[model samples]
Target: MSAEAPARPVGSPRRPGVKMALLAFCMLVFSVDYNIVYVALPEIGREVGFSAQSLQWVVSAYSVGLGGALLLGGRAVDRLGARRMLVLALALYALASTAGGLATEPGLLVAARVVQGLGGALLFPATLSLINTGFEEGPVRNRAYAVWGTAGASGAIIGSLVGGLLTDYLGWAWVFFVNVPLCVLAVAGCYAWLAPDARSGDSRAFDVHGALLATAASTLLVYGLINGPEAGWSSARTLTTIAVGLVLGVAFFAVEAKAADPLAPPRLFGYRGLLTAMLIIFVFQGAINTLHYLFFIQLQDVLGYSPLEAGLAFLPMSAVAMLGSGKLLPAVVKRWGVRGALFSGLTGVGASMIVLSLTMSTDTGFLPLLPAVLLWGLFAGMIYPAMFMAAGSDAAPDEQGVASGLTQTSAQIGGAVGMALLIAVANAGLDLNEGAANSVGDVVDGLRLSALTGGIAAVAGAFLAFRIKPPRAARQDGSATEAPPEPETVHSA
Candidate 1:
C-alpha cells in the first residue's frame, strides 16, 4: 500500500468562497471558448481568405487539441500539482488568445486555437480537482459543484451573445482578445487566493508510452468524429483514421495493464459510483449539445433570426439555469439524494426535448419554444452538478485529478459523437447539394427527428442513473458523516 500523505493543519484560515469563485470563473472561461468563435466564423473565414471547406479547421483544431490532451492533463495534475497546472494553463490561454487576435493568416489563427485547446485540457481537470479536493464531501462539495456548474452552463449561452456583440462592435479579433484580460485576472486570483499545493515525496514513474498511445487514439477519434459529418462518413480517410484510433485505444489498455504506475490507473474505474457518473455525464453532455445545435439552427435558419437576436433569445433559459443550479439543485439533492436527483433531472430533460421537438416549426417564433426551453434549463441545471458530485463520491485524494479527467474526457467524446449522429439524423433526407432547394418544412422535420432521438437517449440515461451506489460515509440527508479513509486498493465491483 502507498503511504498516505500527512494531513494539512486543522481549521486552516483559507477562504473557500473566494477560491471557489476564482475556480468558477476559470470554468466560465473554458466553457465560453467552446462556442464563442462560432458567431465570428463567417467573418474570420472572409478576413483570412479561407476556402469554404477548410474554414472548419478553426474549431476542429481546438477540439482535437483538447480531446487529445485531457488524459495527459489529468495525469499531470496528480504527478505535478493543481496550482502549478492552473497557472501554466492560464498563461497558455493568455498567450494563445493574444496570438489568435493578432493572426493575419488562416493557419496562424488555427494554430492559436489548437494552443488554446491545449490550455483548456490542462485547466479543466486542474480546476475540477482543486474543487473536489478542497471541499468536504457531501453537501459542501455538492454546493461547490452547483456554483461551478452554474458558471459553466451559463457560459455557453453567454458566449454566443458575447461573440455576436463583439464581432459586430469591435470586430472578430476582439472575440479572441477578450480572453487575454480574463486569463490574466484569473492567474492573479489563483496566486492570491488558492492555498499552495502540498509537496509529495512519492516517486512513481509516469507511463510515457501509455500517455502517447492514449493521446494519439483520442486525437484520431475526435478528428474522425468531427470530420465524418462533413466529409462522407464512408470516405476512406475517415474510416482509416477511426480504425487506427480504435487500435491505439486497445493498445493503450494493454500497455497500462502491465505498467507499474499507469497514466490512468485501472483501479480508478473500480468505483461503481464513479463509473455510473461517467456514463451519465456522457449521455447528458451529448443530449445537451444536440439540443443546443438544433435550437441554433431552428432560430437562425428556420425563423430567420439575426445572430444577435438568436443569442438574446437564450436569455430566459440561461437565467433559469443559473437560478436552478445555484439554489434549487442542492435542496433537491438533499431531499432525494444524488441518484434520485439525477434520475429526475434526466427524465425532465428527456421530456423537455420531446416537447421541444413538437414545438419547433417554420411558422413558430421564440415565444412558442419558451416553455420547453425553460423546462430544459431547470432539469439540466440539476444534472451537471449532481453528475460531478457522484464522480467524486468515493475517490481518494490522490485520485481526484484523474477521476475528473475521466469524466471530462467522457463528456468531450460524447458531445462530438452525439452531435455527429443526431445531426445526421436531422439532415437525413436533405441533400446538402440541394442547399436552398430543401424546403423549410423538410428541415424542420429532420430537426424534430433528431430531438426525439436525443430524448430517447436521455430516458435511457435516467434508467442508468440508478446504478450509482452512494459511499457508506455519506448520510441519507446528503451530508457526509465523516471523511472516507484512503483505501489501500480500490476493489473492483
Candidate 2:
C-alpha cells in the first residue's frame, strides 16, 4: 500500500444508488451494534457472573476501543483503500460477534466487544469516506449523507427493540450472534460491488509515534470520562487519568508537527468549514446523548415502564427522524444551506429539551412527552447529516477519511463528557451511595434540571453553527466548485 496513490476516478461508480444503499446498510449495522447491548446488559451480568460495578466494562471497553482506534482506522482507510478497509472491518465484526456469542464468561464477552469497537472505528470512517469521495458535492452528496443518517437513527431505535426481544425469547447471546450474518453480507457486498483500490508506487512511511500518542490520549481520556461520575469527579484516579490523557494529546500534536507523514495532518484543520463543523458535532452529539440517557432513566425508573415498553416508546421519534432525514433534510439544506440547517436543527433540539423539562412528570403519561420527542426528531434529522456535510465540504478527496475521523473523535469525546456531566447534575442532592433509593419527586426534579442544562448546551451549539462559513468558491461566486489542492502547510481557518 502507498500513501499517494493515483486517485481512483472519484464520483464515477457504476450503480451508485446500490453502492449508497450498501454503505447505508453498513452504518445501520454499526449503529445497531452500539445500542443493542444496553438492553441485554442485565442478562449478560447475571449469566456471566459479573459484579454490579464490573458490568459497566461491557460497555466502557467498547467505547475505549472505538475512541482509541478511530484515528488509526481513518489513517488506514486513506492509506489502504476504502473497500479494503471496509472488508477488513466487517470481517472483524463478524469474528468478534461470533466470539461474543459463544463466550461463557464475562472476560471473553468484554474482550469481544472491544474488538467489535475497533472494527467500528474502521467501518465508520471508511463508510463516510466512501460517501464523501464517491458522490459529487452539493445535492448528490447531501442526499447520500441523509440516507446514511436515516439508517443510523433508525438502527439505534431498532437495536433497543431487537435486544429486548432477543434477550427475552432467544437469550442474550443472540444479540451478539445477530451481527454475524449482517456483517458477512456487508463483506460480500463490498467485494461484489465496490471498486478496487488504485495501484500506487509511492511508499511514504507511516507516522507510528503520532498514531500511538493519539490512540493513547483518546483511550485514556474516554476511560476517565466514562468512569469519572462513578469514581467521584474529584477523585485522584479520575483526575490523574484525564491529566495524563491531556498531556499525551499535546504530545501527539507536537509529534504530528514534526512527522514526515503525520497520521493526522494539521493542514486538514485549515479547511474552511472543518473546524466549525467539528465543534458543532461535538456539541450536537453531547446534547443528543445526554437527552437519550436522561430519557432512558426517566422511562424505566420514573415511569415504571418495562424494557420492551420503553423501547417501543422511542418508535414515534425514530420514525419521524427517519422520515425527516429521507424527505426533509435535502430540501432544508437546499433552501437554507448547511449552516442554516444546522442552526435550525440545534435550536429545535434545544427547544425540545426545554419543553421536555416542563412536561415530564411522574404523573404524566407518554402523551405529554410527544411534543418534545417529535421536536427533537424533526430537528435532529437536519443536524446529523449537516455536520458531516460541513466537515467534508471543502476537504480534498484523499483527506476525507481523516476528516471524518476528526469529527467522529469529537463526537465520541463529546458523548462521554456530556453523559458524565449531565448525569452528575441529574444526580445532584441525591445520596446514591451504595443502594440509596431516591424518591420519585427527587428523580423528576433531577431529570428536569439535567434536561434544562442540555437545552442550554444545545442553544450554544446553534450559535456555533453560524461560525461555519460558506466554502471559498461559494462565497466568491455563489456557486459550488471542486476542492482546491491541499495546502503545503497548516494555516489558520
Candidate 3:
C-alpha cells in the first residue's frame, strides 16, 4: 500500500565484535600508559634528575593534549568516517609511543606525550562512534557500551600491573613500547572486522576556533591550578593564566552558540539529567584517579615495595573494580533505578575515601588499606558506567557519538582539574624532605589532604544524584517512525 519501497534500517557493520575488541584494546593502551606512568615516576626521576614541578609535566601533558582534542575528535569521526579516522589515529599512536620510548630528555619525552595525547584524542572517540554504529539499538547497544565501559576500568587496573612489571624489570621505556604492538594488532584486526559505516557529510568542517579556545582555556586553567600554590596563588603568571583561561572559555561558548555546526550542541545540555550527571562524573573521576597516584607512591616509596610489590598491592583494588563494575553494576541499576545507584555509589565512594583518610601511614601494611581500597574500587566501578549510560540515555540515535564525546570530555577535564587541585592541596603545608620517601610523615599528610579533597567532592556528588532518570525500553516494530522522546529524559524511576 506504500507509495515507495520500505525505507532501509541502517545496515550493521560486519563483524562488530572484532571491531569492538580492537577499540577496547586501544583504550587499554592509552589508559595503561596514563596510570602506569604515574607509578613509575620515581624511577624516572631517579634515572634522570626530575624536579618535582618538572615531574608533573609527565602526567599533565597527556591530559592537556587528550582533553584538548576529544570534542573535535568526536565530530571528526562523524564526518571523516569512523574507520578512516581510527586507522590514522592508531598510526599516530604507534609513532608517538615509539618516539616517547626512544627519548632520553624530559622535554622530548613530554613532547612525545603531547603527540600521543593527540592520537588518543582522535582514537578514543572514533572507536566509541564505531561501537555505537555497530551495535543494534536497545539492550544490544547498552550491553556493548557496558562492555566497552568495563574494559576501560579494568584496563586501568591492568595497566598499573603491567606497567609495574615492565618498569621494574624491563625499564619505563618498555611501558611505552608495549603499545606499539597493540597498535599494529589493533589496526590489522580492525581492517578485517570493521568496514566503513554510513557516512554523514554534515560533520566535515573543522572548528579551529572552538578547538584552540577550548584547548587554551583547559591548559591555562590546569597550569594555573597546578602552579598556583607553589608559585604563590596571586603570582602574576598564575593569575594571568587563570584570567586568560576565563576569557578563552567565554569565547569558546560564544563560538559554539553562533557556529552553524557546533562542536558541542547547546541543546544537548538541555537534557537536565545528562548535564548533571556529567558534572558529578567530572568530580568523581578526579577523586578516583588522584587516589591511585597517592596510594601507589606511598606503597612503593614509604612501605619499601618493589615495583612488583606495589603492583601486588594494587591487585585487590583491580579485582574489586572488576567485580563491582562488570558484574554488579547493571544488576544494581536494574533493581534500584539510576538515581538509587548514583546515590549509593556516591555515598559509598565518599565514605570509603573518608575511611581511607584514616588508614594512611608510611609504614602501614596493605592489610590496613584493603577494606578502603576495595570499597573505593567497587563504588568507582558502579559510578562510571551508570553515568556513561546516563549521558546517552536521551540522546538521539544520530547524536550518540556526540553524547559519548561530551561525557568523556567531562571526564578528562574533570580529571585534570580535580587532580591539579588535590595535588596542590597535597603540596600545601609540606615541609621539604630530601629523602626519596620524603619523610614518611610528609607523604602521609599529603595522602590525607588528597583523600580529604576527594571525600569532600564525593559528598557533593551524593546531593546531585537525584537528577538522573532511569532508562526506558526502546520501540520495536520498526518504521520511519518518529524518534521517541528519548526515554530517560525525565524518567522518574
Candidate 4:
C-alpha cells in the first residue's frame, strides 16, 4: 500500500447506501455539466456573441481542465482524504456555477467553465475512490457502481431537458445557475454520510513536477487540436504547439519514472486489466461526447428543432439508458463477466453510431434519430458501469484511487481530442470566415462527416474492448466471509 490510504478501523460501520447516493450525485453533476451547456450553445452564442467555431471552447475548456487535474486530484484524495477534497470541490462547484451563470462575456464564461471543470476533476476521483474503498469487494460493490453509473447517464438526459426548459422559459444563464442548489445539497450529503479518511502513518511529498508536466502536456495537446483547423493545420504555430505538447508528454513519463513520490506511481500501472480499461474508456468516451456535441448542433442547425423539442427527443433514450445501467447491466456483468459486458455494450454503441451516420438526412424529423439514440443509450448503460467497475476495482486495493483518476483522465482527454478531430473534419470545406455567406448544405455536410468520424471511433472502441480481461477474483482460505451489513441510509433505486 502507498503511504497515503490507511485501512478503515474495525467496528465503525459504514452507511453504504447513503455513501453510494452521495457519490452518485457528484458523478451526476459531472456528467450533467458536460452536456448542460450543449443544448444552450445557441442561446449562449446569441447573448454573448460566440461564433459557431468559437463555441467549441465553451465545451472544450471544461474538459481540458478536468482531464488535466484528474490524476493529481485522485492522488490528492489518497493523500489529503476523500471527504475533505470532495467538500472543497463541491464548494468550488457552487461558486463556479454562479460565476458561469452571471458571465457577460465569452472569456468570462469559458473561465468559469474551467473552474467548474477543475472542481469536477477533484470530485470525480474522490467519489470513485470513496466508493471503491468504502464498499466491500463483491456483488454489493458491483451494484453500487451500477447505480452510480446510472446516475451519470440519467444526469446527461436531465441536463439536456433542464437546459432546454431553462433556456426556453427563463434564459441560458439558468442552466449554470441551477447547479448551485444541487451542489449545496450534494455537499450536505457528503458531510452526513461519507466516512472520514484513514490516514497513513508515513507522509509522502506531493509530486508537483509530475502534476505540472501532465497538466501542461494535456492542455497543450487539446489547445493545439482545437486551434489546428481554425488556423491552418500546417501553420508554424499549430505544429509548434503540438510538438511542445508531445515533448511535455515525454517529460511527464520521464518524471514519473524517476520521481520518489510520483503522482502516478509505477505500481498503479502494474495491474493486468488497467491499461486495457483506460484505452477502451478513452475511445468510448470520446465517441459518446462527439455524438452528443454534433447531434445537438445537427438538431438545431439542420432540422430547425427548438431547444425544448430537441431536449424532449433525448428523453426516451435517456430513460432506456437509465434502465440499462441500473438494472440490465448488473445482470449482464454477472453472466458474461466485465469483458463480455464491455464487448456487448461497445458493439451496440458502435453499431448505433454507424447507423446514425448512414441514416442522417437534412429533411428528416425526430423519428429518424430515435433508433440510433435508443441503441446508443442501451449500450452505454452497460459500457459505463462495467468500465468503471473494471478500472476502479481491477487494480490492487490500495491503487484504486489512482486507477479511478487515470480512467477519468483518459475519458476527459479522449472526449476533448475526439471533439477536436470531428470538429476539424466537419469544418473542412466550410466557409467559417466572419461575415461570409453560409449555407445549410455546408452545415449538413459537416455533420455527416462528423457522424462518420464518431462512428469509426466507436467501432474502434469495440475492438479495443476485446483487450480487457476480467478482474481476478480474490481467494479465500477455507471459510467464506459473510458480506458486510447494509447501512441504514435511504437507498436509491
Candidate 5:
C-alpha cells in the first residue's frame, strides 16, 4: 500500500473511449444544477413562493459549497479514496436534487441546493482524479481532459435546453429528478471500468483544521458577495461578513504554510507556471459564468426572445466549441507546442471578447454576434483543455488530483466573484441611467457598460496567460521536460 508514481501503462488497451465518456458525464452532472436551475426558476418560484433575493441563495449555496471546499475535496479524494467519495457524493447529489425538486417551501429548496453543492464539491474533484487514475499522461490524458473540459463548456447550453424543455413539457421538478437516473448510470459505468486508488497513507491523517478554516472563509465570502447585491454593500452585515471572511482566509493560508498535512500544499505554488494559469482561470471562469446570465437577460428583455430563445441562442457557441475541442485543439497541440497553442488560443478568446463587447447592444442580433460566439468557441475550446494539459504536466502523478481540484476551485471562485461584481456594477449603472435617461433603451445601455467589465476581465486573463510557462513536455530544453505522463491535465490553459 504505497503510492505508485508510475503511470500504469495506458490502462489495459481496451479503447478507453467508453470509460472516458462516463467520466465526463459524471463530472458534468455535478454542474448541471448550476445552469439548469436558472431555466426552471420562474416556474419553481410561482409554485414555491420564493422571492427573487432568496432565489440567489440557491445558486450561491452551490457555488460556496463547491468553491469553498474544493481544496478539501481534493485532499478527501486522496484520503477517503476517489471511488468511495465519488459514489457517496453522486448518490447524495441525487438525494439532494430530490429534496430541492420536491420541497414545499423556498427555504427548504434552498437548503437542498446547499447540500447539492456540497455533493458537487466532493464529486467533481474526485471525477477528475479518477480520470488521472485511468489515463496515462501525454495524448491519452490530453484527449480525456479535452473531453472533460468540453463537458464543462457545453454544460450550460445542454443544461439550459434540458431545463427549459423539462420545465415547459413536464414540470420544473423534473429538472432535478432527471439526475437520479443519470447518476445511477454513471456509478454503474464507473464501477465496471475504472480502477480506484487512494493515495498512500490516506488514513495516516487528514487536514482537518485546514479544511474547516478554508471552507468557513470561502463560504462566508461567497455568501457575502452574492448577498451584497440584495443587501447594500455598505451595510454592516455585508462589510462585517466580508472582513471576517478575509481574516479567516488569511488564517487558512497561514495554516497551509505551516501544516504537516495541509489541504493545499504550499509546494504546488513553486511550480513555474501553476500560479499564473490559476489567475487566468480565476478571471475567465468568473466572466464566463456571467455570460449565461447576461445573454439570458439581453435576449429576453431587449430582443423579445423567450426563455427557450435565450437558451437556444447559445447553441452556436456550444456547437462551435465542441468542434474546436474535439477537432481543432488536438491538431493545434500536435502542431504547436503547448505554449504556442495556448497563447494563440487565449489570444483568440481575447479577440472574441472584444467582438462581444462591440455587439452587446440592445439592438444587436444573432447574426451580428456570430463571429464573436464562434471565436469564443474556438479559443475557449483550446484554452480550457490546455489548462488541464499545463497543470497536470507540471506536477507529479501524486499531485494531479490536487492540481485539478485547485484549478476547478479557482474557476468556481471566479464564477462567484464575477457574478457578484457584475450584478453590483450593472445595478449601479441602471440606477444612474434611470435618473438621467428615463427609457428602457438607456437602461440597457447601462447594462452594456457593466458587461464591458467582463470583457475587461477576459483581457486581463489573456495578459495573465503571458506569464504561464509551458510544461516540461512542451519545454524546448532539457530543463523543462516533465517527468513521464504527468503533463496532461493539472495546469491552466
Candidate 6:
C-alpha cells in the first residue's frame, strides 16, 4: 500500500453489503459486552466475593484496555491487515469470554475482561478501517456508518436487557457464556466473506513506545479516578497514580511529536471538523454513559428494583433509539444536513438531563425517568452518525484507520472518565461507614447532583455540535469516487 495505489478492479464482486453487515455485527458485540457487565455487577460481587469498592474494576478494566490500545490497533490494521486482525480479534474475544464465564474469583474475571477489551480494541479500528476502505464515499459510506452506529447502540440496549435476564434466571455467568456462540458466528462470517487487505509498499516501524505510554497513562489515570471514591481523593496512592498518569500523558504527546511513525499522526488533527467532532463525541458520550450507569445503580440500589425489572425499563428507550438510528437519522441528515441533525440530537439529551435532575425521585417511581430516557435515546441515535461522519470527513484514504480509531478512543475514554467522576459525586453523599446501609434520601440526593452535572455537560455538547459540517464527499462530476482499496501506507521521517 504505497501512495500510488492501484485503483479498485472493475467487475469484482466482493459482496460489499455482507461485508459491511459483518463489520457492524462485530461492533454490536463490542458494544454489548461493555454494557452486559453493568447489570450483572451486583450478582457478580455476591458470587465472586468482590468488595463493593472494587467491583467497578470489572467494568473499567475493559474500558482501560480497549480505550488505551485503540490507536495502536488502528495502526496495526494498515501494517498487519484488517481481515487478519479481525480474525485474531474474534478468536481472542471467544477465549476471553470463556475465561470470564468460568472465573470463580474477582481477579480472574477482571483479568478476562481486560483481555476481552484488548480484543475489542483491535476489532474496533480494524472493522472501521475496512468500512472506510470498502464503501464508496457520500451516500454509500454515510448509510454504512448509520447502520454501524445503529448496530452498536442497539447492542448496548440489548445487552442491558439480556444481562438482566441471564443474571435473574441462569446467574451472571450466562452473560459471559452467551458471547461464545455470537463470536463463533462472527468469526465464520469474517473468514468466509471479508476481502484480503491490500499490502503496503511503504513499510515503517510500529510505534510501540508511544502505544505503551498512552495505554499506561490511561490505565493509571482511570485507576486513580475509580479508586478515589473508595480511598480518599487526597490519599498518597491516589495522588501518586494520577501524577504518574499526567506525566506519562505529557510524555506520550512529546514522543508522538518526535516519533518516526506516531500512533496518532499530527496530520490527522489538522482537520478542524474532526477535532470538533471528537470533542463533541467525548463530552456527549461521557455524559450519557454517566447517566446510564447512574440509572442502573439507582434502579437496583435506591429504588429496590430487581435486575430483570431494571433491564426491562430500558426497552422503550431502546426501541425509540433503534428506530431513530435505522430510520430517522438518514432522513434527518438528508433534509437538515449533519449540523442540524447533530444540534437537534444534543438538544434532546440536554433537555433530558435537566428534566432528570429536577424531577427524578425515589418515590415518584420510574415514570419520572421515562421521558429523559427516551429523549436521551433519540439524541444519542442522532449524535453517533453525525459525529462519525464529521470525524472522518477530512481524512485522506490512508488516514481513515487512525481517524476512526481516534474517535472511538475518545468516546471510550470519555465514558470511563465521566463515569468515574459521577460515581465519585454519588459517593460524596454516602457515609461509606454505613456501606450498603445508606438511606434512600442520601442516594437520591447524589443522583440528583449527578444528573445536574450530566445535563450541564450535554448542553455544552449541544452547543459544540454547531461546529460540525457535512463532509465534502461529492465531486464536480456529481459522483463520489471510491477510496482505493489498498493497504494504508505508513512513512518514517
Q: What tens-digit string does per-residue lDDT give for candidate 4 at 294-322?
A: 77777888898887888888888788898
lDDT tens readout by residue for model 5, 267-295 = 78776556656776777776667665666
On TM-score, the candidate that comes out on top is 2
Mind giving the per-residue lDDT tens digits that candidate 2 earns over 279-340? 88788888888898888788998888887788888878887888778878888888778888
lDDT of 1 by residue, 399-477 (tens): 7777777887888788888889899999988978834588999999999999999998898889888777543334342
Which regions of candidate 5 fall more than 4 Å away from where they truly are? 1-15, 198-203, 432-438, 471-493
> TM-scores of all models?
0.92, 0.94, 0.87, 0.89, 0.90, 0.90
Model 3 residue 181 CA deviation (Å) reads 0.7
Candidate 1 lDDT at 128 equals 80
Span of ten consecutive residues with least summed lDDT in model 4: 476-485
- In candidate 4 the C-alpha lDDT for residue 336 amounts to 72
Better of 3 and 4 by TM-score: 4
State, as a TM-score between 0 and 1, how close model 5 is to the true structure: 0.90
Considering lDDT, which of the candidate structures 1 and 2 is the better prediction for this target?
2
**lDDT tens digits, residues 70-101, model 6?**
77777777678888888888888899999999
Candidate 3 lDDT tens digits, 1-493: 2324322224344555665566677666666766767567777767656687688778778877777677767667666667777788888888988998888889888888888887877777776666655665445555565566677777778777888888878998887788898889888866777765665655357777886777777667756765565576678988898899889889989999998777676778787556877888888878877787778767876788777677777878777876776677777776876667778888788878888889988678889989999998888777776776666655665566667667777887677677767877887766554453356788788888788778978887787877665443322322212335432222222
What TM-score does structure 1 among the candidates reach?
Answer: 0.92
Least lDDT summed over 10 consecutive residues: which range in candidate 1?
Answer: 484-493
Worst 10 residues of 3 by lDDT: 473-482
Model 6, runs deviating above 4 Å? 1-13, 427-430, 435-438, 470-493
Rank by lDDT, highest first.
2, 1, 4, 6, 5, 3
* Best-matching candidate per lDDT: 2
